[model samples]
Target: MDITIEHLARARLITTEDREIPVSATLRYTTCDPLAVYVDFPAEAALDGEEVTWTFARSLLDQGLRAPAGHGDVQIWPCGRTRTVVEFHSPYGLALLQFQASALRRFLVCTYGVVGSGQEDMAAVVERGLSALFGGV
Candidate 1:
């Protein structure tokens, strides 16, 4: 599996101390290690003058992304009808991220390819990913 970019969006990183920074970024993952995902933002996107990459362990992210409805330090779930929300909590601060459904669908297709149940439509792939993350919502 190759390192694939699944989605890119205009995002805002919100810190626990109430600091928010705008960014253009993408999410990437590989089949060789589906448990890990990478969030990559360019050097210019960094406020501290360094390129930033965050590797999310499957266990931690799975816990955060599937945090039992309304519980946990990190929470990820659908928002409205066409968006997903990801919130991270830490002793130092919090980070909130959101992405569009259409973009996510494209990312899934690009990363996983249009096959299996998703061959019919790219949205199906996104739906599958969301289901896995939210436990069928």
Candidate 2:
């Protein structure tokens, strides 16, 4: 059975001037795609005025809580003791978001309960990945 877990987290956008803008995101995880985590940003937060969903490795967010992780389009790092920063890059520009560490930890805990990191059924995951790849063709 596929299990889905969702958590609502309050995050702050760190602008170039170092100003913080508040935003809320829906953090989602599911056994259907166990290796990835999705962050859904509301339409108001997007330049195109449409909801945005950023997908990245689940392990990246987990490692980032302790130290810096990721590169390229997404970068996540610890921002002191109680906050974590997740940066997104795109053709449009950049987005730097700061989120409460506790909220992220809580959300990860929920995911672990559902899929238990490192315990995912990779055979199934890979098969599904391949299907999604060629099926869309």
Candidate 3:
């Protein structure tokens, strides 16, 4: 299934620690052979408005979500069915992002070919390889 993001009603970034930072942000998913994910921040006195774009890759989706063990600048993990946990270590904070998992899966499939049933057994090997490449999970 080719999942395309039409529009996001609303999205917010929450902090796990004490911080007075604004968490309002907009998300837009563009349709393409390889989907493009964009997160835009409105202009504010603190920030002059910024937009970040992440290009999906086949290998990334196969690896799934991950977080740096011990301490790290950023952490990412899957939460529940439709939520994702993103933690930023800068100034110590975290954000709970709510998105459609179906859309995510579609984006993954579009970016990277579907994972075959035969590849299921290699999940552990892939994880171990990624962990080693990433300096341990």
Candidate 4:
């Protein structure tokens, strides 16, 4: 699996496995900052990023799209009051990082999570969730 960032209409598209799983994404909001970052992964994949014991989730295989678990891993930070929804799976899990649009900064502050059952709809879920979270835009 590979990950790359590309310019999409007004947001950045983050993808893996030839775009099969969108994972997470960042969108420029005010020319200088991103509007939001979206992430979705599997249960095992999600758990793997919680500690260095396993690098399967944030492994070099998929670039830096995933986070290696740690107490203060910059990749996965506690964003004030954002609600992180983790969808559990027998073999893996799905997570949704929902946060404020104004929180997006120049640096990559968003964390990666596992994608569960409906991963194909991750982009839409992230888009809608962000829109709802920020109230239009």
lDDT of 1 by residue, 5-72 (tens): 45666776666576757777777766544555667778886656676666664344433333323345
* TM-score of every candidate: 0.53, 0.96, 0.39, 0.17
Question: Distance (Å) between predicted and true CA of 50, model 3?
Answer: 2.9
- Ranked by TM-score from best down, the candidates are 2, 1, 3, 4
Candidate 4, poorest ten consecutive residues by summed lDDT:
52-61
Model 4 bad stretches (over 4 Å): 1-49, 52-91, 108-137
Better of 1 and 3 by TM-score: 1
Against the reference, the lDDT scores of all candidates come to 0.58, 0.93, 0.42, 0.30
What lDDT, from 0 to 1, does candidate 4 have?
A: 0.30
Question: Candidate 1 regions off by >4 Å?
Answer: 1-3, 14-21, 44-47, 57-74, 114-137
Residue 51 lDDT in candidate 1: 66
Candidate 2, residue 17: the lDDT equals 97
Residue 72 accuracy (lDDT) in model 2: 98
Of 1 and 4, the candidate ahead on TM-score is: 1
Instruction: Per model, state how many residue pairs clash.
Output: 2, 0, 0, 14
* All models, RMSD in angstroms: 10.1, 1.3, 9.5, 16.6
Tens digits of per-residue lDDT, candidate 3, 1-137, equal: 44344333343345345433434444444323232344444554122344433333233333444322223543445567665444434342333444444544554454334333233335555676688899996
lDDT of 2 at 132: 88
| Comparison by TM-score, 2 against 3, better one | 2
Q: Candidate 1, which ten residues in sequence have the lowest lDDT sum?
A: 113-122
Model 4 per-residue lDDT tens digits across residues 1-137: 22333222212222333332333432321211122333333343334664211122222212222322223212333334532212222334333243332333222322222222223344664786788899896
lDDT of 2 by residue, 100-134 (tens): 99999999989998888889899988898888899
